[model samples]
Target chain A: MSFTVEKTIKTCRGKLLKLSHNSAALNCKMVLNVYIPKQFYENASVAKNKIPSIFYLSGLTCTPENCTEKGFIQIQADKYGFAVIYPDTSPRNVTFPKDCKIDPNDWALGEGAGFYLDSDTLENFQMGTYISEELPQSLASSTDLFEDKIDFLKKRSIMGHSMGGMGALNFYLNSFERNSNGYVSCSAFSPVVNPTAVSWGQNAFKLYFKDYEHEGKKLDPTLILKNKDFSDKNLNILISSGDADPFLENQLKPQNLIDVVTKKNIKGIRVNIEPGYDHSYFFVSTFIPEHCEFHAKKLGLINHLIK
Target chain B: MSFTVEKTIKTCRGKLLKLSHNSAALNCKMVLNVYIPKQFYENASVAKNKIPSIFYLSGLTCTPENCTEKGFIQIQADKYGFAVIYPDTSPRNVTFPKDCKIDPNDWALGEGAGFYLDSDTLENFQMGTYISEELPQSLASSTDLFEDKIDFLKKRSIMGHSMGGMGALNFYLNSFERNSNGYVSCSAFSPVVNPTAVSWGQNAFKLYFKDYEHEGKKLDPTLILKNKDFSDKNLNILISSGDADPFLENQLKPQNLIDVVTKKNIKGIRVNIEPGYDHSYFFVSTFIPEHCEFHAKKLGLINHLIK
Candidate 1:
């Protein structure tokens, strides 16, 4: 659980800690950025209320820098007094020969395309366990993160963009099975909700698992949601997508996730299709306030805009 | 005033228009990104209260995308009902050879460093006339900008970071000499206050002007503040610099501006030295809300935080 602090930048009301640590799950070194809000800094030593955390998973072709530099979540995080953890999309410093019919230059097959899912075949591709389990455990043991002030284990939520959104939904649903205190809520921005129905998922899933047609269905958020009972959990979810997003039609099947929710008559899921927005950070930043508010309210934080 | 729309992106409560137009002033195809607040979009045709505009100048080696993508000014502009104009730092695609001692790889010389000063030596680098004069006129003539709804001619202010910050401070102080209803307020983030005293200013100034030492003083914000009278205009200015900014001590002498304001007994100029912050976009984005509110109040807009 040992970590190295690469850089600590002062931003908003607190600091953005750029950290790199070796993950036993993924084997290679992993890098992540954590934004600790001013509330934790002000009350780290003597506070009755523990600060909740929100893990923001990034999409493909992204380092932690993409969102850390552009996501604009620090403002809302500070306002709502929640810590934001920006984990790497996948493990780096990876050196392996091409496998699973993957081209040497396919961005969706390796490196950044871990899909936050543990490979049934490969030990190195366990991104699901990395993000959902190992990453949280690593953060909990890092005292420099003010573990006493910020809760990394139970009182936390998960959110992601594009491919990460699919991961967030699947992780949030499957998390409760592992522990009673799972994610408080989940949200996504232009997320890939149904991997089984999309090309990006079908292609990548085929590469990761030995039998993607059978193994990939288990990882699909839409498939998981239909069978997963969320009545006990209340299933707080907010999914926002841009109508003008180029990937909306084929790659991101937002409707698949929406259909399951509607058919199951689930409550607390607000799927907003915003007008004139695309899949860039412009779209993510536009609705970050909404997602932040959604997670903030579910986490029992006082958001000025909400109440 | 012929203009081409590069791209229009949806963000916050409005749209960010990426534009490129031939500048008659600089004799180059200048690119800029403008964020028109939702207020203008809502009331472009039939509105009595015209939406005021604010120009944002970016620093060295920056295109309009630097601030447009990562600056995070859209939220506050939407909140304050102000348009933000992000102009390119310097002229690009210059066919002129380096005359007065410039390395082929120097970032501060040819392309990105216009220094926002008209070259008494060259015609292609009239960035001072371009930003302060021609850009406003070009924007006004561009009917797609909805000139009727947005007031680009008057009630507009200027602010920037680094070299752009120097431009904003110098232009704000010198703007009234060109037009009566000049910039209502001026602000900077780690601005080059004493351009004559800094290496960045000295290097770039020598490259731009024939008489750098003598002519550079005329463009220095700190020097101009001493001689320039602002009693009638009630000059409103705000400056913020990070203590941890690498360039703060050498390139950006923020204290030089503060000292002149103190010695000259200038009111409405608030200089804040923030501890632990740096020169990155994190610093700019962190302090954007404050600068927005500062400009909003001076423009007679109701900022929720202030009132």
Candidate 2:
């Protein structure tokens, strides 16, 4: 449960901490970045309030540093008095069974592509358990940085980009409405919405799971979103994808989810197709402010403004 | 003067255009990036008024991409209705005479270390003419992006980091009093102020000029600032250096400029020693908002704000 603080970078109105900790869930060392906002450094009243946290999971081939350096969410987090956690997309430096081991060059499998779901058989590729259940508990008690002043476990929102977008949606759909410990809100940027229906998810599922039908079906947001009780009214599901994203047709078919919402009339679900925007950090950064504001509203960070 | 656009990325409140063009000044192809703000898309009146341009020169070994990606200037440029221009640090894909040529491995004297000044011997290293003079003209006339709508030449301010900071100070000090087209204001981040007193400058001067002492002394901001007439109340010089910058003592002596200003009672110049900051874009991006505000005031981008 202990963590190692790697580097503390002073960014806008906050410090970006690079931390590495041994993960019991994945049976490997995990690296992640946390941005503690200026509110944490303020007086006793702010600390007593116990700030909420937002987890931003990055896409494929991304380390914890990519989004931490480029996403530019720290500014909005500072403005809203919330902390931001950037977790590594997949487990690294772990052993895999011969049946479960994937090709090193395959981007959709092996190292960086964890799919944010626990595999049917593999022990090392248990990203879902690490991020969903274990990471929150470990981070809350890991360092003096939080020290109970930041609520990493209870009041948190989830957001991601591309592969991580798939992770956020799947994680949210899998866990949302089940308990209060689930994410308060969920959003994605150019996410892989229909994973079981897409090639990336198909290949990953085939590689990671022996019983793909049984296990993969449970983590599919396209199916889970259709089944979720959207009548709750507080179920804020925000999704966005670039019209110019190269993977729009084959890989990321956000239109499927939009159609589901249109046909089902899912109340709290919103999907936006940004024009002339590509699937890059540039696109993510552009919409990050809006997403942060959305999460801030849902997480009660802007409760004062609402009052 | 034709430009080949490599990538057009949609960033927050603007579009980041990565462009490469042939530079007649340096007799080599040069790459640059421009961020056109949302103000350009609003209406014809806004276009008629013309948006100002801010030139950001990078330090050693930096491509036009580095600062464009990391400096975080697009936010401010969009906020103030200005276009940001990021020019490459030096000439690339050019040959040099044996005596004038530097080792490819040497970072301080080769392709990435143009020093923003014309070499005394080499024709290819004519960065001074390219950035200060030719760049503005080319950008104004080259493409339909500007098309007599964006003010690249007439209304502009200059800013830089490290060696580029030295370039900003020297270029401003050299041209401000003599010409109407000169930059309206100048600023720097962790700049190498007294180049003549530092080894990087000494080495670069020796390689760039045959008569190193006479020619190199003119490029030194410390000497130029001490010698320039500060009686003009309109002249604004903003400079900042990180206290934790590794080269603070030997190379980036920003304190020397501060001492010169203090002793001489220079009214318009301000130097800030930022605590816990470093000689990195992380440091530059932190204070870039203030720099943009400063330039926005001088360039009349926010004249309405001044009562």
Candidate 3:
């Protein structure tokens, strides 16, 4: 995919830089914001230290800019001294059916719904490869700002909001656990747990995969947990859901994963059901710090200063 | 004025009930989002304890919803056991000439430019009374949510971003010298320090006040500091501005206040010029916790829980 490196600003500590990159990753040229912590900037000798990093996936139809724009993850990342990578969900080049619908109810399926899965049925959607594999490799190999900053080997975690939460879980279960350095932990907010059952998920899944029942299992954490034997890896899983979330009953049923984990005795899964929180960033921002701290501890980088 | 009350769910918290009231004072219907700390719901009597509170004022054209929607203050508020009150800017009943213009250059004067001052020329724009006096009274008298729960007389600090920063500073200066019940420190993000000098301020001043220069002094901290004797107040002031802020040279000239405070040897004022930061919330969120801690210390609230 063709891309353009736009601008880079060196933060106060001089150890981190906020770089904005415009890329034609999926199809439409997208703006991706990457926060490269101070470590890579200061020590060019240790550039290839292969520090573990995390990709913060955002919800449906959200450009990489939303997380950078509204989400305050950069502060926490600075504190944790980790690189934060953000990528857009879907390329805007391709148009889907009913793309212009304004109803919030239809928001989950159309524009924002990349589902973070590889599309087997459609030609345009290859986001699954773009994010999990291609994006990481590009960042690692390119001489751009993120080259030495992203350490995919040491330790890593995956987290997101709404549809991004589903992406985090799907990526963690399907690929990150097997490929990356080590799985520290994964957390999500108001996530769609059983994608095969919900309408939002059904629509996106049908568009992405051919055989719904079989292929959907690979993307559904609830289904994957029933058969995948990841308990031996000591993965620390934290899921936060607001009971008052408008999509809770219909789309984001955290209970689905709880039931699976309970039945299988999943070792390191903790679900926090927040009583009054909804599906907005307010809910995600509340618990995001805990997730960062969770990953920092396992990565053994909690006390490590950015310099 | 008519009003509506909407209950919202906060992640891991009990409930967030918003009071939407139309304020005849400001000629605008305002909404305040109140997050009743989990402690309040867990213990019914805690509601009567007169807990410490913080008032978050948003910038031009923004309602109480902006901070709640994207700012992520509630999460920290919940963790710190403090009640957060978000009051809208000006009333919607009155629309100025600069409302809803698409040009970025017109950002300071138009739809988003309430300036947080009482308009002497425009009868409808008495927003100063709304924020400083009427709003607090309404919070205490009309709502059970804040009446017994908030010690308006005890621990309190005001904060805001952009135009809201100007409001927070104005409110603090007016309220702090009197040794108001909850006179804690105050902070601002990319605040408009000299509203009289910039185009945004000039346009807003002409619309709001008959004597632009003299009335402009009421909103500008630099102008207020010349006549006001804050030497004895022991008020804490934290002002953060980005070196790269697009408005730095024109509208939000924070250096104006810094120069005054430095020359006068202002004891309690602390100015943080964060390098590489801009006019975005990312800049604000980075140092917001420091401002919270600053207020928490003076308010005698527990800061241990935050870390």
Ranking by DockQ: 1, 2, 3
TM-scores, chain B, all models: 0.94, 0.95, 0.87
* lDDT of candidate 1 over A107-195, digit per residue (tens): 87778888998887656888988887888887887776576678888999999999888888888888778774489999999999888
Of candidates 3 and 1, the better by DockQ: 1
Error of 3 at A174 (Å): 2.3
**Predicted structure 3, TM vs. truth:** 0.86
Best by TM-score: 1
Tens digits of per-residue lDDT for model 2 on A1-307?
8889998877777788889999998988899999998888886647457889999999988998788767878888888889999999888987877665577888878788888988866778889889888999888886576777888877889999999998998777767555637888999999999888999988888877888877777777777767666666557889889898999989999888888788878778889999888998888888988999999999888864423
Question: What are the per-residue Cα lDDT tens digits for candidate 1 across B1-307?
Answer: 7779998898887998889998888787888898988888775432667788999988888888998889899999988888889999888887775565667698877688888999887678899888877888878877766766778889898999989899998888887787744898999998888888978888877877888888898899988887778777678889999999999888888887778788878888899999999998999999998999899989888743344
lDDT of 3 by residue, B255-304 (tens): 88888888887787787888778776556666667777777776666643
Against the native complex, each candidate's DockQ, computed on alpha carbons, is 0.82, 0.64, 0.38
Docking class of 1: high
- When 1 and 3 are scored with TM-score, the better candidate is 1
What's the true lDDT of residue A19 in model 2? 91
Query: TM-scores for chain A, candidates in order?
Result: 0.94, 0.95, 0.85
